[model samples]
Target: MRLPIVAGWPACTVMNCEADQAGYGEDKCVTHLSEGELGGWLSRLGPEAEIHLARTQLAKGTLDQIKGAVTGQDDVPQFGYLSLRRAEIEGGVDLCYSRFSKEVDLYGLKVSKYLDFEGVQVSGGLDANFIEAPQGVDFYRAKIGGSLNLEGSKVGEQVRVARCDIDGSFLLRGCQVSGNVECYEVKVSGPAYLSNMQVVGDISFRNSSFSDGVQFFYTETSGYFNVSDSEFSGFVEFEGLRIAHDLIWERASFRDDVTFDKADLSGLVQGSCLFYKGVNFIRTIFRSAVIIQACARRVDFWGARFEVGGTLLLRYAMVRMTGAILAGPTSLVAFNRNFVDIFGDPMDEFVIPHEDPNVKLLDMGSVNAGNLTLVDIDLTPCRFAGAFNLDQLRLEGEWNFGTPPSGRVGITPFTWAKRKIIEEERQWRALRSHPLVLRSGWGDPPDNPRDVPGVAALMTTYRQLRKGREDAKDEPGANDFYYGEMEMRRHNQSWGKGERWLLQFYWLLSGYGIRASRAFGWLIISMILTILLMMGFGLPQDSPKQEAAGTVPPGGGKVTFEIDKEDPRNPIGDRFTSKRFERALNVTLNSVVFHSSDQDLTTTGTYIEMASRFSEPVLLGLGILAIRGRLKRGS
Candidate 1:
């Protein structure tokens, strides 16, 4: 089949030849010209001549003649428009170190061997779409001024475009490569589209730079994709790209945003990339572990998934994953630590520096992992409302948690107690419209009013966290979570009236039995009150004095003695004396320890001892309980 010719191009004058005529009064096509006639015509051709060899079966040694005819003797050889569309080449074609002033169209060309364009320059462009090369195609160190279109091409062996520069867009979509695609040290001034590409071997773009955007949507590679030391100045999209092996981007930099949305990789996606803007990996799937050491402004992993044997590791990466899900056996680590993959096997040793990363795990509200391990990650802003099996989650290192807001309100005398709390509970209490919202100088309301977690949800979250800490043998940390759980229970309106009232009292008196100072302070105050009451109304006026009287009877044979005493009365006057204070002090001190002081007292004093005996011991016991709660260790 003859290829279509451009406008203003004449057909060959030779009979039965459908190829376009060689310009400059050349009536015969290149296929129909004799050896001497071809030499004469080649000598007559100018730099601006248009030669079309469409549907021409170029015999052996004929392609070399054509290349020699177009090549100039100057340092930079320039040729005119050359079309080889639908042409059949009997041997390999080598147009290396030549310059094409206009477009070189090779559409639907059949090459018996490799087609080399090494060190070639195409000013207009190079279109080789649908060209089939059994050997391979090479564009090493070539420079294309305009677009280089190679879509739908099939190469038997490797396609090397290394050290090449393309001024315009580069298209390789729908291409099939039996061998590797090496694009090392290449620079594309315009966009690079390689979607729907399938390669049997590895695809490397190492030390390359794309000034404009790039896309590799739905591209599949049997081997790995290594873009190490590359730089992308514009947006990059790798959506739906599938790699059977690893995808490496070590030391790469992206000036604009990037996305690997919905991409699936069988092997790891390890990288130390530098992203100036956000990089999204939404819905991406990784069968093996992903170890990224990137420093990006923002890196999103929304809806990304990891398989059973895969782990998501972000060492020294400052990323914020708000509302992220850490389901299955995933472990989200921040600082450097020895960790294991999902199958309890040791992972590759990461040599991350032990510096404090200012990374925040904003929200893990959807974490339902069975063995999620968080190490040295800042969780102060995290919300765990929808988490499940958190009681089995392993938390290591100094993982931070939210604390109660401090400072006192206007016209209020006390500040909020400093206690570690969950971010969801804090947000719930910060809501202005909530019934139990902290309206007294707590903090501002939640950013989104609808996102505030319910008290029951917070209660469950705190209970699980408390259980997890307890299982780790961290009683001090567990107590903080327990305090949070009690706070949520106290504020829950659905609780029974009596239970709520009891909770309120428990919180007010001893901070749910976790405040030793509060309980002890009340114990001291109770003793003082008991002592004052005894001095006022429970002491007698004075001690009763005994007297004896003797009477003589019947002849002075014997003398009889009679003794009598007055009952103890209440204090009459001068009761506020030092002597009364000493007796009252003695009674109060013994009552506090449940011991009796044997002393003279009225009926009121006897009843006062009975009340102090019951109340003082309870307050002291609560103080001891609070102290134990603070220092108790898990068994």
Candidate 2:
């Protein structure tokens, strides 16, 4: 028979045969050799010799003869170099417990059934790119010294690389697997490039460890993309990755930064991951819920979009969300795990804390708050500038805002009264440029320039937050925000303007109608001043007397009596008499309630009563307004 031509090796000595010599210096290929010659050729096989099976069809039992020739001590098949490029395996390839000192070249090789490499150890890399495996490929418990490349390969069934320890990079780029790709407990010393891969079934690296990181850029998987319990030591990139189902990463730890930029997930991206560094989800799109219960340093969702009815639960996660966009009706929760998992499911693992794993920073600078719900999350470090539809934002449960400075600051008389104010207001007031702010001991200004919101922006933020609190029937909480809003407006206006002066007076009198004690104190002071003024200059020196005169000539039948009273003069002396003090006290008390007292008074005392009627009543009204604000409930 005319055999196929194999390049880069001596051809078989059989006439018109171009098959490569099976053994070194062999006269014929494996197909052309007789039983006696094949036995002699197999006897000469050693572990140091290269094996070229390229472009040749291997019979069912031929591998048994080849395996026996290369079997070393302990009955393990050993080879220096093995090439099966473009070769067809009739009975499939099973190199179980095989040891290869050099590379294994399976380029363009065709295996009709499963190819087993169970317990195999390869010193050199495996170049199985573009190989055709109709059944499956197994490298279970295999130890590879170099890279395990399967680029552009088509596996009809599952590809098991579980328990594999790879020294070099593990590349499956552009490979298509019709079945599951199992990579459980695998360890990779080099980078793992899984880009452009398409898997019909699940591709898992569960419990795997990657020392040089991994990439899944543009990879599309129909099933779940799970890296649960895996550890990544280097940077990981999953940009443009598409998952038809959920992306689970429960209990996974990432030592380096990770990015999922521009990724599309049809299902949820749920995880209990621990990231020591940062993670980015820039421009990513999620169709379902994103429930990440991770303890990450920072997690950026910049420009990411979510679908409707999706929930973003970050229970027990110490993460900071930056530039995230909640475009749809998304329920966001970042409460403590105990607060969320109150049902006490047995399967839920209790986390041991290095620190409290709760959200510390939430940057809502680029978020759309239209259909977002924030529940029980700390907003002490939250930034809300450039947020859209903030008035429609829903705040549920006890949302915590930035608290004012507690206790007395230094020996100064100024102390920041307790109030829940937004972070922007604190940042603005903490600026060194404002002497009053410094005197109030607002601490340091924000280190980031972007955090310092303008007066107008802070006003808008406070107004929107106040509206949200009012909508939620939290009048007490909204009162603080209202005070902040008015403060911002006052700060924004020029001191010479009437609006600023009016606000200043309002703040001084009643703390924008929220401080009942301050308003009442002002009212008491006004009453005391009025009493002293009335006692000093508002009482007459003596009581005015009336005289009656009758006109008898014009009307004899009726006596016409005219009562004449002299205008009282200003007080000359002894205005502090007991009788004068009683009249002054009576007049001042009536004017406090906008009532006029029927008492005789000097001209100066009359003017004083008119002023008291206007001013004392106003102060009393202000006190009442302050009380109403403190106790007002939502209607």
Candidate 3:
């Protein structure tokens, strides 16, 4: 019942062919052509060949459900138009090294095995939209003049598009790739739409470039996702993305806004990345370490939660936004050398080593976590320009303010002076010509600015840290932070004018009730100064009438008579004597120790006595408290 073969064209050379199909002017039929015959036919249709032959209209290659149909060619075949729409191929499609001058549409195509398009060049667009491949899809080294649309496609295995260059938008929106997705070294001239995509395996886009924006909104990846060494010319969004494993963006560059609002990230590594615009990480949760290094215009991490077991490090990053919030408990939160510009103009230069020109504010007014180790962060350089608002924030770990320990041995006084000279020269050179530095002390009075809230903010942070240390039973550490709090209060000019002086007096006398050893030391110095004063100016002698009369009764050698009074209280009463050392000691003991010494003092002595009477009790009380561990030791 088979139809007879045509006379001019060759008969179908495929085994068991029932239909009278015309061959491709070769041995094999168009439907059952081997890869070698397909390459031969494509060679005849080159760009320099006859125009009619190049436009030769081939029949629709419908090899639906074909078992042994070859879909690959060896050489780089030149094709006019290849339409495999709705075709169901059993074997894989291997079109490696092929070139398509026109459109290649694989819409609604189903491939039972892998589809390889490696090193292929499509002058027109490649439309594989809605294609279903149970195996993988490879597009390695491919070049597409137009969009590479794979929207709504499903790939059961991995999709490799490494080193591909797409001239138009690359859309994979709403697609599901069960295996890994690789796009290393790929360059896309247009926007890349990956929104709503789901990948069950890892997704790597290392060393890629996107001229337009890219979106991974609502995408879910169950494996590690990396975009290292990539460059995004436009906004890159990850709103609502969920990644179950590590998420890396190391060495990447984003020219515009990059957002991760409401995303759930695992271990994140954004180190050494450059963000030219703002970065929004609002309402996100990072399950592991989130390391970032950048100098962004603004970085917002409001309402973000960082789980335990990992540190949040923002090393050397300069952010313009108010301080980020870490809602949940974190092990460690470090902002090493981070510069923040909270109150300055947004257009101001905010980079490091030059941030001192602007008001660098770090407003942590909304943090609500505990037991966080804050490390290697100095607020002093910024505090000179602006405030570090730590209101309502609670931290209960080792607080390192980035100051190195002070007592280094082997530093001679000459060396120290030389270093100081060098440092002063450097600072002067840096700030001498700057307008802000020139105007710093012009309008302000010699006294510190009275109404600034920076002192109060520092006091609040110190108080909270002290309370946390106290709650943890760290008495020594608590005392240290308490001393800092008191120091801030002493500098606070909001206290009445007299009250500020009173606080300063308290610090001078006893170091704000924390330095008992200093009080004791001052006590020793006071007694010594009193002794010197008494020695120089003799103690007051009673009037001659008040002294006892000279008694020369028995054994009169030189008429040894009592020149001093013999009252019960004044056994060694005030008398003119040559023993100045003894007299000085007696008067000093009487003044400092509040004892009845054998001497009566002059007006100056009485005044010294009155001052010592007031000072001794305070010094004694401070010493007692220090012994009882109520005050900081050696504070």
Q: How far is candidate 3 from the true structure (C-alpha RMSD, Å)?
A: 12.4
Candidate 3 Cα deviation (angstroms), residue 307: 3.8
Candidate 1, superposed: residue stretches over 4 Å from native: 1-6, 13-18, 46-49, 309-328, 336-356, 435-437, 440-444, 494-496, 543-568, 572-579, 598-608
Q: What lDDT does candidate 3 reach at residue 130?
A: 81
lDDT of 1 by residue, 1-635 (tens): 12233666677887887877766667777778888888898787655556688777888788777666666657444577788888888988888887887888898888899899999988877888898988999999999988887889999789899899999888888999999988999999989988999999998989999999999999999999999789899999999999999998877778899998999988887655666667887778877766655655556776777664344455444454433455456666663543343455543333233534445666555656454777677778776766678898788777887777577644567667788877777767677785542554546778797888778888888898899988888888888899889988888854568889889888877888888887778778877877777787788888777878889987777888889777778888777788888999899889889999887778888898889888777777788887887788878
Best model number under TM-score: 1
Which lDDT tens digits does candidate 2 get at residues 426-456?
7777776767635365667778756587999
How many clashing pairs in candidate 1? 0
Worst 10 residues of 3 by lDDT: 415-424
Ranking by TM-score: 1, 2, 3
Tens-place lDDT digits, model 3, residues 1-635: 01111134323455764322323355544455466766565444443121111112133232221211222344345565565554566667777777777767776677777778999898878888788887889999999988898888899888898899999889888889999889899999989998888999988889999999999999999998898779899989999999988887766778899999899988665445557666877877777766554556556666666664245444333332223445344433334344232233122123334432221223333444343344443232222112132322334333333221233323432111111111111222233343553323223221334323455665666676667656655566566567767766776765669878888887777666667777787778877776766655545543223564566758655665556643222213534356756777766666555665645666566676677666765677776675555533432
Q: Each model's number of backbone clashes?
A: 0, 0, 0
What is the alpha-carbon lDDT for the whole of candidate 2? 0.79
